[model samples]
Target chain A: MRFRYQMWTVFLAVACWGLGSVAQAAELTVSAAISLKEAFGEIAAQFEKGRPGDKINFNFAASGELSQQIERGAPVDVFASAALKQMNDLDKKGLLLAGTNQPFARNRLVVVVPKGEAKVTSFEQLSKVGRLTIGNPRTVPAGQYASEALTRAGIYNTLLASQKIVFSENVRQALAYVEDGNVDAGIVYATDARTSQKVSVGFPVPANYSEPVVYPIAVVKDSKQPDLARAFVTFVLSAQGQEILQSKGFLGANQ
Target chain B: MTDPWFSLRLSLAVATLATLVVGVLGTAAGYFLAKSRFWGKDFLDALFTLPLVLPPTVVGFYLLGLLGKRGWFGQVLFAWTGWEILFTFQAAVIAATVMAMPLMVKTARAAIESVDPAYERAAYTLGKGRWRTFFQVTLPLAWKGIAAGLVLSFARALGEFGATLMVAGNIPGKTQTMPLAIYQTTQTGEDTTALALVAILTVTSLAVLVATNRLAQGRPW
Candidate 1:
């Protein structure tokens, strides 16, 4: 009888410890696009300030890489993609929480050259450069826009045939090529181009280039913290969140 | 549809070039480390072996800084020639060489040191000079181990991804080696092509390992 009493007390003590940790704050993980790193970091800090006990972790990478991780069942609660295609694919796969998808932001594509460089002033001049870097069109949304823009401008084949084009894994890498002066010019998102001090926009691609760059976000279906995930998504779609994204050079969905 | 063998040929070229360079340089470093006793030898040994435990991306990051236009040596070269070498096949070769060098040096050093000291003493008694004795005696016995290290370095160079990606920038038909192609193809949802490339790499790596092991062990039969 005495031994049973001691065992019951120990079990209660263990249960109390687990409950105490839970009260300290549950962790919420959000996987976002590499381009969204700065914007989302600010948003997460704001979100965390409201819920003192909540801790948010972010995994940032290329949209394709992040989507592939989600497809492989990474323990992600929220996914915000820089492009609609990745979110759309996962939504079609029935892997996203129903009705939680929201179009939060958009971005424009631009061509950039290294600081103090005047060799190429416009997009049409891209064909003349020896090396013009852009993200890989197969997966990067910004690259798709650039490729389509060049095609519409009637210079895609010219650049390809001339071997004046190079590919980067993502938008920032494209910007880096121009920033480092390794390439004569590069095409990347206007937002990404702004992050570098050593590169400036040479020109903005026309709106007729490709599909509009839309950023869609949603909660993953298998989230362990569904309420928290939905709440975080709600916070991002809020007016203040849109304001922060705009400050970072992103556009409102309506724009 | 884009020549499927393009990436494979490029990979072989990079690996072969990297192996040849590392073979000569690494062997020399290994011989010195094994044969000499100097101050700070442990520190020097640690520096050479450090890459083995570091992530390839970290090595690539350092190499990028070292070879970029504003880098240490790069600033000098660019100031003189108004050009930088990043995003070229040469950059890819450099990355692979930096990454694969440690393994070759470590293995070769151990093998050279394992050569019996008694044989060297006997050669000295016969009035053979140090250089001739080393060339005739030390090198012959250590050849198999050096061969094994070279093969291993070649295989490691073939799969180099992160550093190559950082410095070389994945351009198809230009800087894209087999492993880079496999990763890019996989990301683009071309799983079949990626898997095919992976299979080719697997077979080539296995053949390299088997052939080298047989030769190194003197059991060719």
Candidate 2:
């Protein structure tokens, strides 16, 4: 019994130690799209190394989901979405600081398939594609772009009717469907496609077929760390930031 | 207002259906375990109660794998019927049922075990058949416990999130049940809508708990 008590006491001490570190960290909560996980991790490392006084806290999910959280009063310091609509909507609600909302980077919509299986080079080819996985358009910006591109290609209704849709909650999950070889193809942001070595991006959908893909960043109106948020935003739009984005296959905002 | 109402209706519908299926199956299984001796009875009991200890995500992921068109059983069914169950209302029902089954079974097994076996023996000696003895004597004595189990199942089914999302895919007006709605609203900063729905769920869950407690106390018995 004494041994068991000692074991439990040690276990409790370890658990409390784990939580204490998390509670004590100087966290800056930045809500971002799921696609930004890899990029943000690298950026956070550099940002922390330079600042040395803070850590970046990321709340990553579909842009729609993150936008809702901000509007509903989540204590997020920064909002970086894969699309402008959600950020713009938040701005319209006066939830973002003026002059804070700006396009920082861009990404393209791409058709992705399992590596070395088949190739798709044109938008029109999507109509004949089998097992197309897409994020739910109602909540994911990448899915909306895919919808617009498919509609412009005049294959939206055909693809819808084929009823082969596999809806993931976010672009990352949609990308997983393609990477895991579960679906023959998936529509995901070019940034998301770049994350996986198991899948190869087939081709970019023509820009004319859909609205320009842009990532927008904003400081929350009630941010406790607006300066830090702005710094992160500026870093994203800076030449160095653009280089990082470009290296990850993301388009520069200036383009 | 309209969105919350729709979400609430969907939640109730899903929960009710799930409770009905799980309550029946769980009670039957529980009764069998409590009273009958069978091969691997202990193992079967453990298997049935596994979901109680298992994480919801684990259950949800397995459901996703099993219900996807390319999955082992799903592929066969899809080929036979040209149908896909994943990301559909049917899949939501399945997820809720799986998540709620353990609660129903656990509650029901305790209730069944609490009954005096002397009652069953008495009925049998009076020449009552096994089925008749169970229906007339055992069931009536255990009605309160069964009702409590049903309510618990309903409450569990209503709060289901992870499994439902994994299986149903959150298609609005199709598979976006209440929990998914709340998640969507919260994710997008629709605080008013999210809080309102949460209030509704809280009230409903409280009512279920109170009602179950009253029944368990044999208030109406």
Among all windows of 10 consecutive residues in model 2 chain A, the one with the lowest summed lDDT is A17-26
Predicted candidate 2 versus true structure: per-residue lDDT over B33-150, tens digit per residue: 8988989998998888877778876687677567665467777887799666755556777999999998888888888889899999999999999889989998888877887888
Which model scores highest in lDDT?
A: 1
lDDT of 2 by residue, A178-210 (tens): 878899899887776766778997887877788
**Which residue runs of candidate 1 sit more than 4 Å off their true CA positions?**
A1-25, A119-121, B1-221
On TM-score, the candidate that comes out on top is 2
lDDT of each: 0.77, 0.75
DockQ-derived CAPRI band for the predicted complex in model 2: incorrect
Tens-digit lDDT track of model 1 for B42-81: 8888888877889887787677667766467766777799
Model 1 lDDT on a 0 to 1 scale: 0.77
Best by DockQ: 2
DockQ of all models, two decimals each: 0.02, 0.03
Give model 1's docking category: incorrect
lDDT, candidate 1, residue B123? 89
